[model samples]
Target: MKNPVLVALFCLMQTLILAQSPTPSKPRILISTDIGGTDPDDNQSMTHLLMNSDLFQFEGLVSSPSYGEGNKKEILRMIDIYEKDLPKLNKHNKKLAKPDFLRSICKQGRKGNAPFSGYTTATEGSDWIIKCAKKQSEHPLWILDWGGLEDIAQALHDAPEIQHKIRIYWIGGPNKKWSANSYAYIAENFPNLFFIEVNSSYYGFFSNNTEPDTINTSDYYNRVIQGGGHLGMDFKNYYDGEIKMGDSPSLFYMMDGNPEKPERESWGGSFEKITYSPRTIYNQTTTLKDTVAFCSIIEIHLKGPKIEIPSDSVCFWMEIPYGKTIQKWPGYHLGNGDYAIRYIPKKAENLHYRFTSKIAEINGLEGDIVVSNLWPGKKHSTDYPLGNHWYSDKSDINLYDEKIQGGKTVLKWRNVILDDWAKRWKWLK
Candidate 1:
C-alpha cells in the first residue's frame, strides 16, 4: 500500500513540471515574393514553402515586384498545384494550410519600384501586411522578403506602429539592386526593427563547389525533387530543375533552429550585427575618383536652372552592362534649383547617365560614375550609424569559399537540410 499524501505530492510535482515546460508553437510567417519575375527562383522557394506549410502559420503571400513583372496570379498558380497535392501532403502532415486559405491570403503589391522617397500609394499587399501584423498574438510576425522591399516600405510608411510587432528577413543582393529606394527607406527610418539582411550569404544555397556531384545544383532536382509530386514535377519549369532558390534560406532559418538568435549557427545561415548599411550621396556628377560600391545605393544631386515642372516628369537614363540597354530611373525635383536621382549599380562597370525632364536646363544633364565590385558590407564607411542591424559578416573566414562570398555558411548544412527535404519529398510520392 502507498501513502496517499506522498502519492499526491509526487503527482503534484509532475503536474507543476508539465505546466512549466513551454509548448512548441509554429512561427507566424508572411512571404513577400517576386515570383514569375525575371528570376524563377521564387517559384522554387514558394513550392518549398507550400510543401512545408505545416511548419508555419502563414499570414500572407504577397507579390512584391520592384523590377520584373510578378503578380498574385503566379502565387495563386502555385497554390493551385499545392491544392492538387494536398491529399498526399496531408497524409504526412495534417497541419498543412489549405489551398483556399492560401489563395485568400495572396495579395498584389506594387507593380514597379518606389520613387526616390521610397514609398508610393499603398497597395492591397501593404494593407494585408498591416492587417496581419495587427493580429493579436504573442509571437511576432516574421516577414520573409524574397523580393523587393516596396511593399514592406509602404506598409511601414502607412503603419509605423507595426514595426514593433514584426521581424524581417530580407534576401538582399540582386533584389536590393531593384529595390534600393525602399531598402534605403526601411534601413534609415526603422533602424531598431528586428531585421536580417542576407545580401551575399544566401548564395550558399547553390554553392555546391565543395559538395558531391549527386547534391550539386545541376543534379539535385533529378535525384531528390523529380517524381515526388505535382510540386516536384513542376520544379523543372524553373531553372530546368536547378536549385537556385536563394530565398529558401529565409524559410530554412525558421525551419531548423532558433530563429530569434540570427547570430547563432543554423541550417539557414548565421549573421552578424552591423551599425549601418551603405548609402553614398554625390552633390554633383561623379568623377573617376568617386567610385561607388556595386549594389549600394548612390544618389546624385544636380543643381539645375529653376523651372516649373512636376517632379514626377523628371527621369534619369543610364547605360547598364547587364541589360545591355539604357534604363530610365525616376528623378525627383527639389525646391530651389535642386534635383536628385537615386541609382543602384547592378554590375561593376563604368556607368554613363543623363537626366531628362520637361525642364530644359536639367534635360540632357550627363554624369559618369565608376562602380567597383565591392558589396555594401562593413568595408564601406557610413555617416548614418543606425542601430545594430543583422547582416552577413564578411569578416567571418568560415562563411566563405574561394569563389563565393558567405557560401560556406549554408553549404556546411547542405547535406543535412537536403536529406531532410528529401524525406519530405518521399511523403508526396
Candidate 2:
C-alpha cells in the first residue's frame, strides 16, 4: 500500500510529464507593421507581409502608437481579421497550414469598435503578445512593431524574459522613436537577441511635383482605363453595384482608383529615408541621426492636398502573407485617404532602390530571373541597396503539408487596404 503523500507526488510528476509535450518548432517569418502608426506606408507594409507569408513564419502582429498617432484599436481589429483568415489561407494555398499554436494565439484577445459593452475587452494587446511569445519557443517569433512603441514597450515590461526567446524586428524610430529607448528595452534587457529596425517613415514612398502628368495621358488612360488593365478595370469589377463601400476585396483593389479625381490630383508623402548601414548616415533628420546606425538609403517625396489635421492617425504592420503579384506595382497617396498609383517612374528618384516581389523574385518566376540584371548582377546596379540587411526566422515563408488544393496563394487586393479610414470613422473625408 502506498502512502497518501507519496501518491500525491507521483500524480504531480505524471501531470507535469503530460503537460510538457513536444514543443512547437520555431518558424521563420515575414512581419508587416505600421511602425509609424499613422503613415500610409504601414498599410502597404501590412499588405506586403500578408501576401508573402510563404517567405515568413509570421507568428503574429503587434500594434501600438508610433509617428504621433494616439490609438491603434481599429488597426488591431483589421489585423485580427487577417489572423482569423487562416483557414481560408489553408484552403486557397496548398503550401501552407498555420500551426495550432498560431491559430490559438491569434484569439487570446482583441478589441471591439462599438464603444464598449463593459463585458467586452478594451485591449489586451500587450498581454496577449507576451503570453503567446513565451509559449512558442520552438518557433522563433518574428514580431513586427509597425505602430508606436506602446504595446511592445509594455510587452517587454510584462515579460522581459520572452525578449531573449524571440527575434525582434522594428520599422520606425530614430528621430522620434529614441534608439536609447529601444536599447534599454531591447539590447540591454535581452542580450544576444535578434533585432532589426528600419525607420521607413522617412525613407518610405512619398510624392513630389517634379514629374509631369502621367496617368492622365490619353495613351495611359486607354491602356489602363479602357484596355481593362487600368484602375477602372478593378473598379468596374468591384463596384458592380455595391456602392456602400463596405469591406470587400474589390474595395482594397480600387483604393487608388479615382473614377472622379483626375490624374492632376495624385501625389506621394515623403522626401527621403535613411536606413542603418554598415557605415553611413546621410539621409535622416538630425536628432538621433548619428546615434543608432545606417544600413540603406532611399529617396522620398510627398505631394497631395492637406486635410484637416485631426491631431494624428495611428498605424501598424500586417501579419498575413503577400505574394509577388500583389507586390508588383508602385503606389502613391491621393490624399483624403484615397490612394492612386502606377508602375511607371514619374518622380525624380522613383527608380532608386525600389523593392517589390517582382524585382526580388520572391515566388520564383522562371526565365524572368532578374538577379544578374539587378545591381551589379544585372545592369551594374550599386553593390548595396538599403545597407544594414537583416532577415527574420519568422519571415521564412513555407508550404504546409495539408491537402489544400488550388494554385499558389497570392495577394489579390482585398478590402483592408481600400476603405477610406475617414469614412469608416464617420468623420471628415
Candidate 3:
C-alpha cells in the first residue's frame, strides 16, 4: 500500500505531464568547414554554431582546404578566427568569446601559441573524421559540413566501420542540372547519408566596397558586436554609402521556391540549381549529386542598438599588419582583419540556457549569428562599461570625431570605425 503523501505526489506528477511540460532533447553535432573558402557565409556559420553550443553537443570542428592555390592560406585564417581571437576579447573587454563552431570545451585542451590551443589533433581531417565516427558510442551524432566534401569522402573511403553511425547535415554541392566547376575533383560515395545542400552562393551577405585585400570592414565583427539590421548591408546604413557586405555572392540558391520544397535542393554554398553540367568533366554531362535537401541562407533578424566605434575609444583597440593569414596555407587570404575569435568547447549539455535560442535559429550548424545585448551585463547608452549592450548612433556623444578619421569606420561614409582611436591625446592603451 502506498503512503497517502506518496499517492498525492504521484498525482501531481501525472498532472504536470498531462499539461505537456516535458524536458527538451539535446542535439549532438560534429562540424566541418573550409574557413578560408572566401565565401563569408562560412564565417557566419562558425559564429552561429559557437553561440548556440548549448543546444548541441559539438563533437569536433575540422578546418579543411580546397585544392585551389589561394584557398590554402584562407583556410588557416578561418581556424585562427575561431581559435586565437578568444584571449583578445577577454583582454580588451573582460569577456570570453566562445567558439563559433565547437571543440571539447569541458575536456583537457592542448595549449599552444595560436589555433593549436584547444582542439582535437585531426592531422588528416578525413581520417580523423572516420576515427571519431567509428568510436562514437553515442547515437544520432549530427555532422555539419560547411565546406568541400573531400574530407568526408576520404573518411568514408578509409573507415567503413562508421558508415551508419552518423547523420550528416551539410550546406554544399550543386544538386540540380548546373554543377560546380569542382564537380570532378572528388571521388567518394555514401548513400546512407542525408544531405542538406546549401545554396550558399545565393546568399547576399558579403559586401564589396573595394578590393582592398588588407583593409576591409568587419562585417563578421559588427554582426557579433552590433545588432539590428539586414544581412548584406544594414538598410539603415546603406543609403549613406555605408556598406557591410564582404562577398559570399548570390548565385547559390533560387529563392523563388521554398527551401523545404524538393526542387529547391541544390549545391552547397552556392545559388545555382543542381543539374548535370558538361562544364568541368570532358565536355560531357554527368550525374553530380550533392545532398538530399538543398536550401539557401536562413536570414536571421537581429535587432539591437546600432552603436558606433568612436575614435576616442582608441584605448580599447588593437591590430596587427598581417592579421588574417593562413596556418596551413600561408598564401591565402581569409579576410583583411588581423584578429580571430576562439574558446574552449564545453558540451552543450552544460550551457543550455545562455545560447539555446541563437543555436536553434541556425539549425545549430552554420548560418546567421544571433548576438544578444545581454551577455554578462548591460551597458549605458552614453557609455560602455565593457559589458554586453551596444553603443548605438543614437547614443549621447556624436558618433563622429573629426580630429581622428580613417579605416572603414567613418562618419562621412555613415559607417563605423573611420575614426583614429590611436591619437596622441587618446593615449593608446
- The candidate that wins on lDDT is 1
The C-alpha RMSD of each candidate to the native structure, in angstroms, is 3.2, 20.4, 23.4
lDDT of 3: 0.31
Q: Over the stretch 1-429, how does candidate 2's per-residue lDDT look in tens digits?
A: 289999999999989998998743324432323332334445434433443344444555444442234234434444454455444454545443344433433422222111001111224666766665777444555554444344555566666687655554454333222222222333223434444433321221111111333112113223322322122233233223122221111112122333121111121111112121221212211222122112122211222344443212211111112233222322223346322221111111212122222212222221100111110111113222232222211111221111110000111111222222212112100
**How many backbone overlaps does candidate 3 show?**
51
Better of 2 and 3 by TM-score: 3
How well is each residue in 226-291 modelled by candidate 3, as lDDT tens digits? 332122122223323233322111111111123223223232121222222111111111122211
lDDT of 2: 0.31
Candidate ranking (TM-score, best to worst): 1, 3, 2
lDDT score at residue 94, model 1, on the 0-100 scale: 91
Every candidate's lDDT: 0.82, 0.31, 0.31
Pairs of colliding residues, candidate 1: none
* Preferred candidate (TM-score higher): 1 or 2: 1
Candidate 2 stretches with Cα past 4 Å from truth are 1-37, 67-123, 174-188, 200-429
TM-score of candidate 1 relative to the true fold:
0.90
Per-candidate TM vs. native? 0.90, 0.36, 0.38
- Candidate ordering by lDDT (highest first): 1, 3, 2
Cα RMSD for predicted model 1: 3.2
Clash count, one per candidate: 0, 83, 51
